[model samples]
Target chain A: MNDLIQTGKYLLIISAIAGLLLAFTEMVTAPRIAENNRLVLEKARREVLPGAERFDTLDLATTDDAGHPATRSLSLGFDAQGKFLGTVQTVSPKGYGGPIDIVLGLKPDGAVSGVKIQSMRETPGLGTKLAEGFLDKFLEVARAGHPVKFFVKKDGGDIDAITAATISSRAFCKGIRDGIKVVQEGQTLIQQRAAAPGATPLPGPATTPVAPSPAPAPAPAPVVPPAPSVPPAPPADPESPPPAPTVAPEPPAPPLPPAIPQGGGQ
Target chain B: MNTKELTKGIWAENPIFVIMLGCCPALAVSTSLANAFGMGIAATFVLLGSNLIISLIRASVPDKIRIPVYIVVIATFVTMIDKFMAAFTPALSASLGIFIPLIVVNCIILGRAEAFANKNTPQDSILDAIGMGLGFTIALAMIAVFREVLGDGKFFGIPVPLIKDDPCLLMIMAPGGFFVFGLLMAWKKHLAAGGAK
Candidate 1:
């Protein structure tokens, strides 16, 4: 019993010292660690929303397709003259390995401006192809103002899923679709804030009415003129105008109906 | 202080080969040269720090609770390196992943603390750490180079033409690690035997 008490005292002293040392180290490194994280997020934002002169964090509430609240915020991109360019949203959808965090930039009219994968634990060579080849297709469809489809050719959608990484590919598509839904649901409020400069858009309380019908059709027109103007100026542009139109209507093709059921069952 | 304590870990008491300590990380992170080197350096930092501290406090630590005290000391250093890596070298930190934290449980560290540090002077303990750490790093690098060149057909991500185009993919997988580790161990044993003769 005497020896036990002595051992207990020694253990307590060592643990207390260890705890104090760790606390000191944490205090010293916390700020720098936070700064590193912010820099990574900032770089991802810039990559996703290229050509934006500046970015502003907009406090906007987002909801899922089921109208349940989802945690997402919009980063508003503006040109040199403060013209509203587009918005960047972060979405994490369930991927094969784990949650794949994607940073998506969308034009005010619901087109994809760009996509940058922020973080993912997908298989090194296979699922990781989503960052390399697979993302380009989504960017192409979004640039053309087409509804995004989230499946591969085997499932009857336009996307050629990553070889042997169909699940990861589908997860990528799901994240993109979820992001687009957020932009669509919050479109009216975003446009209102964009049009009325200096107006603080309050986070609406529960049951914020889905804007009345016919809003989606007219919303694309004003945003469309600016979209074409920026892409054509450089002759070096890879995604030229002609191919976009041909691919734009493909998302609305019969493949979508069959793809939905297959994705659901899987 | 005796120079034998420092020189022994380099060859005779080599951590990975002869001593055969800390093999879990040796196999797991040895897939890439860069990853292997990073794990090596992080482990070295923890080993050196823990050994020095344990040596300094060896007299005061009671035999009845020495293991717990040593663990607390080692864990403190591991946490420090883990945070420092995350802040300064985020990419390396991400690639090394769980192995960085696992350094706390690495047997080479605790073994040294028990075998060498507890009985040695601080200066001797520091040298032992440096020698053992370098041996571990070199061993891991050797294994990494073989695996990477054969498995991925790349030496540090630079593709070799014939091998890169058609390489044995198994070298980067779990079975590949075991194969290389066994071969390397046998080769080291052969070299030691020849040297002795």
Candidate 2:
């Protein structure tokens, strides 16, 4: 009937008007939403690299070992002075319940500057505790200035995994280690590509570190020093004696794990 | 236009407590009164807009695609609200998280469109939406006040007079949401039944 056609026309007009109103709203909010996301990412950038006046981005390709997840080129951020700040990689690890997204700040020397939880979906008050001060423990151990490259106390890492939330803790630790590995892999790939006939040799720190090994503190499991464990300073005039003899061991904990010079002298 | 429908929305047909329409926010943002207020206003705006649009086109919409049409209208509004909040109220937006975008799916807006707008005139639908949205906002605000006062020992981050002395940590948890909703529902039903006498 003609009435049915008129009804359809009205419906069409009404929906069109509604749709137009929504489109206008989307337009108004689009810029603001984008700014918000940028602000958040910037805040995380600041947390990971404190005193960073400005940040610069570098491209580094990353691929998983299984070859399933292939992200071409993670970003390496730097401060205003062009000093290497940290590589901003979305460290996605299988968290307690789901995926935990984190951004890791790696110093030029390979030690972590800081780690920020970008996003996560874990049980509150339980697994969520992993987001609390858990990453800070890794940072504290890293204040010694190195990456978290091993396991928990029970398994033998420098970090204290959250009590009762081992899964969340491990998830965070693994995210950093793996993210670092990806960057390393990318750097190698770039270096190799540069050596090729058509490529420009990339200028970067040689992956091979050349230095002496730093002394690791007494780990409960292995009381033996990983290198030269400095003997406790004598109680008398500790500062006056000066711990300069330990200097040969103090500078190599992070980058020299593989590149320590032959020192039968130790 | 009439008081029956209007009063029904305020209590008998309450969108949240009795009907439990927007439960996502009920459980999600009730941790703090500020967050709850933000969510309540967002939902109310969506409800008001959708109700008006649906009622304006009620006669013309084909039954087959009415739901889809309603969804589009709701989603558009939600996206707008989401962007605005992100830009202007960054802190509250972060606390609210994804619930803002998820407002498109809040059952209260769609429920009102289908149940009331489809049968009512524009003015009546508008009134119904306003009354029901206000009711939903009040319910969420009440739950949020209780949780924030007990759980954090404060109101809107200001230390409550005596709550800080003995705060209840339980009110801020997921279980607290269920407890508040259940208690409020029971109390509302009791009052309605007793008033009938």
Candidate 3:
């Protein structure tokens, strides 16, 4: 009976101390952890869309232009003049391995500002390539120079495919294309309301219309190298890219196409 | 109850190689030297705190609910370490993911409290705690060195010769972890046998 009583007493005391320590730990570090996450997210937002001094977030209803339910995002970025610079929103797409989380940025026009790959447990060398190639496509795609609707070659858009890692290329391609479609629809809605003969319109970026001609033909073969190697686009060459570098930084690794190589852009 | 008790944990009762507790973090985070170091420090904090408190109450604690009591004590330290890691080393914390919380049941600390510290003096318990922690750290570091070099073809993120340039993709995969662990275990056993012979 004495032994039992002693044991019970010890248990109670240990339990009380444990509870106190745990509460103290939670109190001390909870705020710091929260701050760290916020800081990192902000950094990622900036990297995804640079040149914008400050930014805000928007709750884009996941409803597609068709008014169907889907994954919506809280958009982040800054407004530079009438144009929304660094406009970024995260989108998750299921890849061959797992869900790939991507941040898509849009410049003033409906073109891509850049892409930030936030999370992926992709196969290291192969699937990981998707996160690296944002620049060539971002600059060229964001320019909206080509009147043709943007599509990754797999979807028949002119965008070239990464050589071996086709699936990652397609996943990234789909994400950027879908993001463009969403932003354009939003812009159109804003424009429609403003152009009404009597009404002063609400402010927003002008939406680009989805082209009647759909994304270009698919790539069954002839893995065209990405823009990094494509004879420097005549203007914004990364080798000596112009003042406001049109090319986003490539992934640290060497360019994709085994055959054609460029000056190592360390 | 003095230094010997503590020193024993560093070698004889080393958690990773000898007792085989907390193998998940030992292998998972041991991919990089930095990660291994982070894990080692985190585990050490938990071990030291838990052992100290558990020893303080060993005399009073009732046998009926001792397991539950120990769990609560262990959990408190785990939370402290987890929170500290998150705040101070957010990058490492993010990389470690769920492994930090799992330290609660790391048999090394709990096992020591139940076996050694409960029976020993406070000073001895603390030493044992420190020793065991160091031993675990060294084991993890050794394994990480092998894994990072062979797997990613890098050491502490710096590229190495031939390997990093045109890597052998296998070392980074899940199977590679098991391979490294088994080989290390065998090597340790061989060394021990050789020393004895």
Candidate 4:
């Protein structure tokens, strides 16, 4: 009886100490972790909706495909002049392996300006192609105009599948199509938010929105590659070819895509 | 500090190659040099902290409740380090992803607590912790070098000439991790057997 009591005391003491230490660590890291997450979200916003100098998040209560009530949020982007640029939103489409998280930037006309895969669990070397040249092909099809079938060529759509990764390709298309629909639905709300005066400063870099020129094709101005030490300007070459699509490799290794800024940026 | 405790883990009884305690993470993160270093350092921090605490309380921890006590201590350290890394080193945190949280279950840590720190002095335990941590880091780096260079055709993210354009994709996959891990284990065993004499 005495040994049992003693053992109970020992366990209680150890757990209490462990809990206290964890609480202390949480106190210290909570703020910084929050800040880091904000920065990451901001960066993703900029990457998707290039030239978006200010953003307003709109919570949209809508319905899913199953007609269930789903609340979705949209980050409406505006230029330095407070001119509406487009909307950047994230959507998860069911893929072969699992849900494929994709962030998309759309022009005012509902054309896809940029596409980035936030995360996915697809087969490597195959489904992973959604992050490489396949995205470029996707953007081309998107810019071709609305009424896109949003299916693999095999499924009677315009976009080409990543060879054998047809399901992943199909999922990518579905995510874009869904994101575009969200933006279209929330267009009025986005314009209202943009019209509100005294909007907050842009996320990170102070670079003002480039060229308010009226062009249907908003340059997918790649977020200046998060290198503050170097001059923000890229060498002016007429034919450098748009930067290669961010490489998202397969699982078990290099799950990170080069698009992600390394520790230096962090 | 005893030299044997400090040095044995580095080569003679490497946690991965010989003792073979935490091969899951070793193989998963060995796909890239950067990932290997990130995981190694994070695990080392957890190992060092847990070993010290376990050693200090080893005597008082009743044999019946020792395993639970060790787990509480190990988990505390892992969560603390995981939170710190995520807060201060977001890039490394992002790169390592789920592996950091998973360190709570890494056998090398609990293995050391039960096998070495439980009966060892605090001072010797510290030395053992450092040695074993270094062993884990070196072994991970060795695996990462082959996997990244051969599989990805790159070294530390920089493209290697000739290999960069057409790297062997298979090398960066799970089969590749197993292949490199097996070959490296065999080589380590061969060396331990003194050139297979």
Candidate 5:
């Protein structure tokens, strides 16, 4: 009993000292760590929305169409002269291996300006290809003012899925759709905050809305002209003939034709 | 203190090649030289700090609770390093990921504390910690060099001449890690035996 008491006493002392040391270290490093994280987020935001001199995160109190509050903050970007550039929002959807965080920038008129992947834990060679230019197609489609399609060609939608990584592709699309929703719902609030002088930020609501299913093509007619326009200019440049043909054919042909045979074989 | 306490960990009792300790991280982070070096330095920092503190409190620590006390000391050091790295070198911290936190359970810090720090004086404990830490670092670097060279055809992120275009990708994968580890262990054993003869 005496030995047990002695052991407990020594352990307690050691633990107490360790705890105190850790607390001291945390006090010193907490602010710096927070700063580092903020810098990383800022860098990602800038990449998605280039030319924005600064950003202001609007505290939107309004709920979505489903009546639940938004979970993400809608950041409004401004130029050097303080003109409104667009809105930047981040959305993380469950990917094949894990959640994929995507940062998307939307033009003031709701066109997609750019997209940057914040972080992902998908498979290295297969699912990770989403970061390597696979997402550029989505950016192009968004810039052309077409409704972002969430499914692959096999599912009666236009977006081409990554080879052998359908799940990751679907997750990436879902994250973009969710980001668009956040931008759409918070647009009025963002405008109001920007217009008013020193507006008090409103707190976000408690419950986050469940993201709704992909809505019917908002404007399908505009998509057809952009598709042909994308291929012609690059191919006309004789200096880059090899790369143009390879790029044009690979994006449209390889995924669709082979997908039918591959799906049937499986 | 004799130099044997210091020199022994480098070759004769290398924490990875000979003593076969901390192999999980040895394989996990050896995919890149930068990661290997970062992990090595972080482990060294923790080992140095833990050994020093444990030695200072060796006598006062009760025998029955020595392990827990040592753990508390080591974990505190690991957490400190983790936070410091995250603050100063966020990119490296992100790439190293979970391995940084796993340093708490490395076995090397605790092993040295129990085998040497507890019994030895503070001066000798510091020396032993340094020797073991270097041994661990060198072992990790060696594995990383071979893995990075053959797997990615790159040396410290620079592409090598002939091998750059068509490198053997398997060398960076899990099976390749086991193969290289086993080969390195065999080579080390061969050298030890030849030196003995």
Candidate 6:
């Protein structure tokens, strides 16, 4: 009993010292770790929506096709002149191994501006292809046009699936589709917010576009003017100084979608 | 300070090959040269810190409670390294993933604390820690060189000339890690056996 007491005291003293050191280390690194995480999120935002100089956090509240009410938060991107550029939405689609966190960018016209996989736990060499060559292919399709039928070719959709990692490919497609829907849901609010900043009357060439009817028109969805489908110019470098404000100011505030139709039937 | 204590761990009692410590990380993180280097340096830092502290407290630590005390000291060092790396080298920290935290359980650290630091002078223990840490790093780099070049057709992510386009994928997988580890261990043994003379 006496020896056990001694051992306990010894362990207690050692643990106290260990705890103090850990506390000190945590104090020193906590702020830096938080800063690093912010930088990572910032970089991902820029990667997905290149040329976006500033971002405003916005929320999208809607019910999915299955009527499950979901709330998604996104970043509204704007150029230096406060012209609305796009929205960056993050979605976690169910992947083969787990939830794959994907960040997607949608132009004011509802076209996919860019897509990036933020984190995943899929098979290393196989499902992990979602981030490699497959990402480039997906981006190409996104830039090709709006209202992309985001399904794998095997599913009678346009995108090509990674040969052996079809599940991850499917998840990528689902993530893109989900992001578009959320941005569409929040389209009206996004436009209002975008317009409030510049406070400039809509230019004669740029009329308030007819808000898209909130009906579930998955294809040819989002009726904002084609805006010449100006492809989102790839930001030269994500880590470099912000792009020059000389961005050819596209007509600000693409049309707003009409009132969100509650529980629009699938 | 005896130089033999330091030199012996480099080859004579090399941690990874002869003593066979830390093979788990040796195989898991050896998929690339960069990962090996990161893991090696992180583990070495932890080893050096743990060995120094344990050796200093060797006389005062109660015999039965030594393991717990040593663990507390080692864990403190590991957590410090993990936080520091995450803060400063986030990229390396992300690629290495859980392997960084798992270093807390590496047999090498606890093994050295028990075998060398507990019984040796602080000065000698420091040398032993350095020697053993280098041994682990060298062995891991050897396996990583083969795996990355053949499996990924790259060295440190730079494409190797002839093999860059078409490389065998299996060399970077778990089976590949085991295969390379066993082959290297055998080669080391053969070299130790007088090189077929």
Best by DockQ: 5
**TM-scores, one per candidate:** 0.70, 0.63, 0.64, 0.71, 0.69, 0.74
TM-score of chain B of 1: 0.90
Higher-DockQ candidate among 2 and 4?
2
Between prediction 1 and prediction 6, the one with superior lDDT is 6
Model 1, A75: alpha-carbon shift in Å? 1.4
Model 3 spans with C-alpha error above 4 angstroms: A1-32, A63-73, A79-82, A90-266, B84-99
Q: Which one wins by lDDT: 1 or 3?
A: 1
TM-score of 5: 0.69
Q: Write the per-residue lDDT of candidate 1 for residues A1-266, one digit (tens) a residue.
A: 99899888989988998899899889888888889877888888878777776666544454544655444677777555555677898888899868888988876555677888877867544576687657876567546534544556676665778755789888887787777665554454445434333223322221122434443332222222222221112112233222233222322111111111112122
lDDT of 1 by residue, B92-161 (tens): 7656544665586689899999999999899999999998998898888988998889886888778888
What lDDT score goes with residue B4 in model 1?
Answer: 83
Give lDDT per model, in order.
Answer: 0.70, 0.63, 0.60, 0.71, 0.69, 0.75
Calculate each model's fnat, 2 decimals: 0.50, 0.35, 0.58, 0.56, 0.56, 0.58
**DockQ of the candidate models in sequence:** 0.37, 0.32, 0.37, 0.29, 0.39, 0.34
Error of 6 at A154 (Å): 10
The docking quality of candidate 5, as DockQ, is 0.39
| Clashing residue pairs in candidate 2 (N, C-alpha, C atoms within 3 angstroms) | A60-A73, A60-A74, A61-A73, A142-A145
lDDT of 3 at B104: 66
What does candidate 6's lDDT look like per residue over A186-261, in tens digits? Answer: 5555554455445445432222556445445433333332332322333333432332232224442434454232
Indicate whether candidate 2 or candidate 6 has the larger TM-score. Answer: 6
Task: Sort candidate 6 into its docking category.
Answer: acceptable
> Over 4 Å off in model 1, which ranges?
A60-70, A83-85, A90-266, B85-99, B195-197
**TM-score order of candidates, best first?**
6, 4, 1, 5, 3, 2
- Sorting all predicted structures by lDDT, with the top scorer first, yields 6, 4, 1, 5, 2, 3
Per-residue CA lDDT of candidate 3, range B1-197, in tens? 46677676666666777788778767666766766776677678778888888888788666667778877777777777777878888876655534565466567778888887787777887887899889888888888888778876789878898888776556555567778888988777777677655
lDDT of 5 by residue, A1-266 (tens): 98898888888887888889899989988999899878888988888888886676654333433555434566777665555677788778899867888888876655577888877766543466687648877666556545545556666555688755789888887776666655554443444433332222322321112233343322223211211222222212133222233323322221111111011111
Model 5, range B1-197, lDDT digits (tens) per residue? Answer: 77887888889999999888898878877876776787788788788888998899898888888888888888887888788777787886666444555577788888999999999989988888889988999998899898889987889878888988897878877777788999999999989888555
Question: Per-residue error at B45 for model 2, in Å?
Answer: 2.0
